[model samples]
Target: MRTSALREQRHPTLTPAAIGRAATLALHDELSLTPKPGLVTLIDRGSHDDMDAHTFMRSLFSLRRYFVQIAEAGLAGAEFDVLERFGIAAEARMRAATGGINTHRGAIFMLGLLCAAAGAVLREQDEAPRPADLQRALRRRWGDALAQRSQRTSTLPGGIAARRHGLRSASEEAALAFPVLFEAALPALSTALARGLTPQQARLDALFHIMAVLEDSNLAHRGGLAGLRFAQRTAQAFLDRGGVARPGGLQEAHAIAGEFVARRLSPGGAADTLAAACWITRVCGGS
Candidate 1:
């Protein structure tokens, strides 16, 4: 059969490897973003004592193949259990690479689902899926499974914190198709870029926007619910002062980062959400 004919027959979309590359690149974008309150970067370890940029790079290397595998499975219409198995394996590889540090655990779940959904959407449309198309595919395909999964008790600190505080866990966020990513973070990113902000500035705005609203379980895990609320207020204050657009905005953000580090409060959930937003911008051709 001709290439066109073969493409029309089935799975007429991006390669799993290409999809994986997009996912990995998204994570890298998030990691490279500096002055992120309480998050790791190339220059410093934010609030974390165990991991740094090198550790994240190692985790990224370990999970590279896992994204490809999950994307391939989604291309084949594999069930949630299949994707879960891939995630489990990816987590193991990440732990081994980082000497048991949880550098990208939340990312593995959030971005992993996104990559799978991207594969499914690509196979269906024979093109890169838009944010809306991708979200619809994910919820239609695996919403129920994620919803069921969210009910189970979790031993992870974020999950435990979420349950204890009545905030949504990452699983719950997934079960609802990641409103913060699609609704908040992506829009903030697109708007910032559209308004002529530089790439780094736009991403910083998006990260703060997410932090301003998201019930980040990692924040709660670190400093309890009060800590999470403080982070939210701080981020909102930055945006209210014109984000990175005003003269002193960047300095203000840096100051906020210093405060976060001092407090030992890491907004890992918000970081993962930011990564997912980055992935959407890349995969869906968003500005």
Candidate 2:
């Protein structure tokens, strides 16, 4: 909507060269919205000239539309229910897949809620950090699930190291990526938020931006430990190289994400996405 201004102002961080490199990688990877054959490929052919801010914005939004589909589908009724409910059943499933009681749906839903909250802040222009709303919403839907006790299961096979190898199901992999995605995305969002956008809009905008970059590149498909590592490194590198154009955006998001990884992962800073998601769940509600 603010097309003219967006085009005129030179984004200090995102250089033409950096965006080009990222865009080139995105074009080659072509990770589509749907898991359906060639759907993403079909969508990939559209215009994505990162040279133009309008085009870049459009391209980013386009990717958001698609990733929302993928993210939605990656989580279906069962998985959705598990996360929304965040209870013993979800725990059981995780236990069955991994050897230990590694994660909680409560955590995932909480992350989702944080996304919802941040999305609301950025998009809605609502009041700032309504702890009551967050607590109430979480309690209303996921209260029992969170409260339901977990009967500590056996240790995970491969000592949690094997989980990162990418042999896990798509849903599991996504679960892993959730935290990492937030780690990489949230700080940029926060910086954007400080620039007069609401928290919700800022969060959604940042996520949309990342998804846009991913669409151009195919980061999601390369899902093993190495692949995830690459994604993390790339995100950090992009930030380090001043790709995110905002005052304090890159550093804040990175610090939050780093704290998350250190606290959650088995290794205390396992650079996995799921580990990042776990960390987001705890602090994303504006603590």
Candidate 3:
């Protein structure tokens, strides 16, 4: 297909309401995916004792307006500094909703940026944006600011862990336009769907694929480099066994969840990427 024609076919009409609804649905989808290794879901809290599925729901509820507002800001061609302020306020609301628990901090940053990018693309091109367009918009609009932000010192546990272990910080990932989400998670999810897997199965496959490669600071903070390595190996092994396509795959994932919980390792970063992948799929009309 021709490039512009393909974009027209793939991109959906994006409004602030549509963007917020999609963001909320994506986060809910992520929370509903069961047996996510070292992550929270409706059935279990994989590794963390502090939060659960309900906590995540509260965080989602709190950030609904934030997503819409940020998307609106993007449509208005707001600067990076403006978006950052929105994120900060949203984080405060999230913490308040969760009673000081940091459930959706990463999502506030990652999904917020993507939402803004989508809005910007819609306004600039006067058409729906494909995944690639969103990626390009992110870089073209705020890549320099993201890079500069990546250089600042971070006091958060995830940032500290990334720094201490030489893993890419979340800011670094964003500055590079979310290579893991665009390159790995979305592709895995799309391929699974193409192979006739259900949405849940596709998401699970995407989650494992992300866990295999993401330098998840959550794992590092909880179990350090050894823990991170163990997560990657486990995820890689699952994929080697054909991921969610294999017979008994769900059982194997459950087993892995058990192991991750026992080790106190949570792939929160990977989980966030999975959510972002879902958002891209929805926004871009990916089957």
Candidate 4:
């Protein structure tokens, strides 16, 4: 058995502020990752015409306090309704920071909940929780509430597109506790890392995995069902070609990025999930 000091050294006490900073840095890391098909990055504006990396950064800065507040709420055992109110205020702040552009809106919801879950888990444990533990905590604490929330129709573009295309809305994804993030993105990232891939390569692979499976309403909204199907097929093809494990995989991913841009298809929801995966990795001390 490990000594108390050693365990403490391994799992430092996670404060709400630290958790919030981790969430923000995870978003930054995702934005810094290159060649994400139909997503914004530091080098290219994938498929979005309204925002870039700088815009994402500004939104991240604006939402820092929101994450901290929600994390604190989780530590205090606040209800989901209260957390939703915080999220609503944060969304308004994000739009204000981005000049009415919807940068980081999806992230603010998903990552915000994840942050809160982390706080709740840490509060109940002597040591820091693992990624799986945090995920379980999220579902155990908020699954029922999330399901109830998902029952209501969404008025956002992604929700509207999902309804029209018969795809899962963002709320539905949350209600199911983000199976794509946990089952697809997280596992893909962990596998890539175990295979000795670089952080960037692993994250890229994870993003593609999410794109392959997630019915990203952003893609539906932008390119319609046809666009969503095309994006899914393209992502699946990349994974079949050995993802980041194969030789020339990075080049192929960049090529796909160009294609997605030409088609004006942006899988923003998948991109957000990729960031959430990164956040989980970091929170679980996998990074």
Estimated TM-score for each candidate: 0.95, 0.30, 0.95, 0.97
lDDT (10s digit) by residue, model 3, range 87-184: 99999999999999999999999999999998898787765578999999999999999999999999999999999999999999999999999999
Tens-place lDDT digits, model 1, residues 1-287: 69878765443356788889988998999999989999999999999999999999999999999998998988899999999999999999999999999999998999999999988886777666789988998899999999999999999999999999999899999999999899999999999999999989999999999999999999999999889999999999889989998999999999999999999999999999999998888777664
- Alpha-carbon error at 164 in model 3, in Å? 0.7
Candidate 1 residues lying further than 4 Å off, grouped into runs, are 1-13
| Candidate-wise lDDT, in order | 0.91, 0.33, 0.92, 0.90
Candidate 2, residues 1-287, lDDT tens digits: the string is 58855644432222222222332223222222111111112333111211222332333333222222222322232223443443344344444443442322222232343333322332333233233443444344334433441122213342233333433322332333333344444455556657766533344334433432331112223333543344445445544654335566545544533432332211111212222222232223321
Error of 1 at 23 (Å): 0.9
Regions more than 4 Å wrong, model 2: 1-132, 139-187, 196-205, 208-221, 246-287
Q: What order do candidates take by TM-score, descending?
A: 4, 3, 1, 2
Runs with alpha carbons beyond 4 Å of true place in candidate 4: 1-3
Query: Which sections of candidate 3 miss by over 4 Å?
Result: 1-12
Prediction-by-prediction clash tally: 0, 20, 0, 0
Ten contiguous residues with the weakest lDDT in model 4: 126-135
Q: Candidate 4 on 1-287: residue-level lDDT in tens? A: 46977888878988889889889988998999998887899988888888998899899999999989999988888889999999999999999999999998899899999989988987798567787787788899999999999989889999999999899999999998889999999999999899899999999999999999999999999999999999999999999989877999999999999999999999999989998999888778878
Error of 4 at 121 (Å): 1.1
lDDT of 4 at 179: 90
